[model samples]
Target: MSEPEEDLQEEQRDSTKKKKKKEKRSGKKKKQKEEREQEEAQQQVDEEEEERSECVVLRGIFKLGKKSHDVLLTRTRLTWIPITPETPTGEPCVLQPGVVLTAGRVRGEGEAAASGRPAVGGAVLGVALFCCRRRGRRLEEDTLHLHNASAEHTQTWYNTLKELLAGFSSRPRYLKVFINPSSHKKEAVHIYREHVAPLFKMADIRIDITVTERKGHALSVMKECKLDEYDGVVCVGGDGSVAELCHALVLRAQLDADSPEKPVKPVLPLGIIPAGSTDVVSCSVHGVRDPVTATLHIVLGHLQQVDMCSFLSQGQLVRFGFSAMFGFGGRSLARAEKKRWMPSSRRREYALVKTLARLRPEDCQLSFQPAKTSTGNLFEHRDEDQDVKQDPESEGEESWTTNQGLYLSISIMSIPCLSPHAPRGLAPNTSLANGSAALIAVGNTSRSEFIKHLKRYSSSSGQFSFSFVETHAVSAVRIRPSSLINWSEEESEEEGDSKTTPIIQSEGAAFPWNIDGELVEIANEVLVRVHPRLITLYGEEVDEAESTVSCSCI
Candidate 1:
């Protein structure tokens, strides 16, 4: 072979080898890129799953020697994550296992302010007969001070196996409960006995129940009961029961006092366990009136305090969880009561029939004092004393002043919503603990006008100004007909002329009045004052913002 042929062949082999090496490098790079992308995708999926499961519920009891503590909790709402083992100041030892829990709030200073000690949430973690501290440890010695973190050297054990519960959720500090059967409804007692008792077994509470025997018993009961005993009271019957309950609860505070010398406290709380013909409160508070879910809230120990108002007639007080109203429409309450003897299913139609027949302009006297310039203005004591030296005779006319008008009905409430059926409720500026009342009256004539007012009251669609409302706080009220007031001539005649209509005399006679949901014949005048923390309510201490916004207050 020639020298030229050998050189050409060698060059051809070198070029082919270079091409093969380049192809191998490209394939390897492609494979690496694909593997990198796969890993990134898997990592992204894992990250998403972790975020969804970021919530951790740790429940267990800490045992120091022979003593054990119970810890019941739902979730911790915090602004920052905590990493230290130190016990937060003012916060109780919630790390202990087997402790019963309820959703609660904790206030402390700085980090300590948010600690969960002095839990106001009305959650009962079973009965704690005693809480003894360790022999040498000085922790929990002062409830007002911040608790120190348990020393690592101190001996302690946690029991997490049996006490660790899963599937916990967040909840409120107050709840609404209804007792429907109350003897008048066949299933009210059964429902309470079978279901309500179990839920109560899991919470802390002071309950007020109204049992109706005759038809309007619930209404009369609601008109007379004290609202301070509960965070929320519920009705277990049908629509009429709810309506009557709401009607009585919606009456504005006529006087500050439940009793003359002692001012009344906040109106009781409201809730419903719908066993009635119609469950408006239930449907409104929650979209559905599921008994099991309602029972679950009690079991889970959720609580919230709501606002209410009081109405005064003569000198007696009537409290409203919703509104204080009058007019011929209030007769619907009496009619609904009379129809209770019929089947629950038929009560609605019968009530409508009675309402249509009895619809009329109920002539009443309405006197109102406009809402003060500010809430501070409600309390005369809180104002500047410009008249401390004024003549006593000049004060007489001001002290005995009164306003009067004619009306088909009058209603004032604490909440903006009533019965879940009516929208516009108590004055928006009112609060459960603010120590004031809303005064509303309807003077419209004819059934249509009365209904229009009723619709406006119930729909809550109005954007009313201060001019449309009369809000005030007073110690007494006087209600009487501006014109000729008539008692049922038929009912009065049966007792003969000697009865003299049992007139609500300005001097000596007792007038029938509603307190909370209970009814009673009270003395002609109701003297009211603010009740200072009369009953302990287990829930968040109402904040200024919430008190100013919605009517749900504690």
Candidate 2:
């Protein structure tokens, strides 16, 4: 064959390969185009569905700042889109219903109305939306102004917003307020007037205020007051005030049912305004200890049903509380109570220093009933014998676990007690309404090691990772403290030292217990049982909290 014939055959093969490669590339581009079109179509359908779910109550043209935009009001949100020449409907600025506090007409405004822009066609008519803007853990009030040229248009928007806000049934119309005048810094009244009253007035909520004169004044009011007229009860004080109100409300329900054994749930919800030093309950529920945030939670009608613990001594009702601490906690509080003349802050510091200087463990016996594997409603009151007979399959299993020894501190909490000192809470494993409580037992250890364990609560995690600490989820607990005189004498005799006296030496003396920040004295064993969803509070469950404050006493 000739060289020219071989070159012609090679050229023919190269042309055929190039044609097949070009066809494959074209087919790939066509398939990519088809996939892109399908994705776009699905996104459009999804947007349409979301719009349909949120029915638009009103839509019109309104000016935000200096720009003319299309505003839309829905049942759950208010949104506005910038209308520019390039993009007629630009990105929307959405305002959820939870953030909006109220709306009203704004007349004769300067910067608040269109950034000092004069009305183009007629007199300036504007509507202002009052909203609570959340920045991290704090909530600040802000205003969004929308102006239009027509007066009737602005009036229509204002009226519609007012009617929509009124339709929220969860929000309270009337509240029975009890203000304790002797809270931290004696500023409970001032905090309410400065930060809380104006918001309630703006929301048109009628409040019947009563300034408490004594420690149990709120309880007295709760006993005789008409619960039907008020939508809810508001406590403007510390955790003690909150605990007192809770006990009063629960007792009232029991009396109304004419059965102390079978107490019913409270008919009205309770709202707490933080005015105390350590606002543990307020911080746990609202995730912050700010008064405005608490009031906003009440105004927004956020509901959280919390578990409650009932303390009984000698088979008699003592009180209903959310959390309790014995040993060091009780002794410190008792010492603080003795120095009532001192300032609250100074009193707490003095008590803490004194207690730490004389840190000692108490001899106590603890018995707790572990929670069942499958969670059930704990609200229904049942006898222990009845529960045991009903579950015959678990006859061999032990229901209660007992532990007796010396302990520096023991804490039982139904809700995670979140505060500034403890960001993750003293009981980080427990939840708000989980039908169980967290039993934390700290065994005897050196003072330095114990302080290290206490200081770990403020960190992010690992607060209960110490060798002397133990945690369990329980439904009921019995705490019995040994006689102080008897235990001390026996120890001194064993050591052959007659000069050693008991830390708290008294005959027939009562044991001090810190329950929800209140000091209670009991001479015998106390049984604490958890009741799930016993009372509804005006706040949402908090998963995490941010703390900017720390304790320096350690």
Candidate 2 lDDT by residue in tens digits, 334-444: 889889899887888898887766677776777777766424322222222111222222236546666666678888999999988888888878888998898887777
**Who wins the lDDT comparison?**
2
Stretches of model 2 off by over 4 angstroms after superposition:
1-53, 86-124, 373-398, 484-507, 550-553
lDDT of model 1, residue 138: 12
What's model 1's TM-score? Answer: 0.45
* RMSD to truth, every model: 22.4, 12.1
Best by TM-score: 2
lDDT of each: 0.39, 0.77
Question: How far does residue 505 in candidate 1 sit from its true spot (Å)?
Answer: 13
lDDT of 1: 0.39
Task: Give the alpha carbon lDDT tens digit for every residue of 354-462 in model 1.
Answer: 5544444433333333333234322232112111222232223334324343334444543333233333233444544443455444343454444444445344444
Model 1 segments beyond 4 Å from truth?
A: 1-180, 183-185, 193-260, 263-297, 300-303, 306-323, 343-364, 369-402, 423-434, 456-460, 463-477, 483-486, 489-554
Q: Per-residue lDDT for 268 in model 2?
A: 90
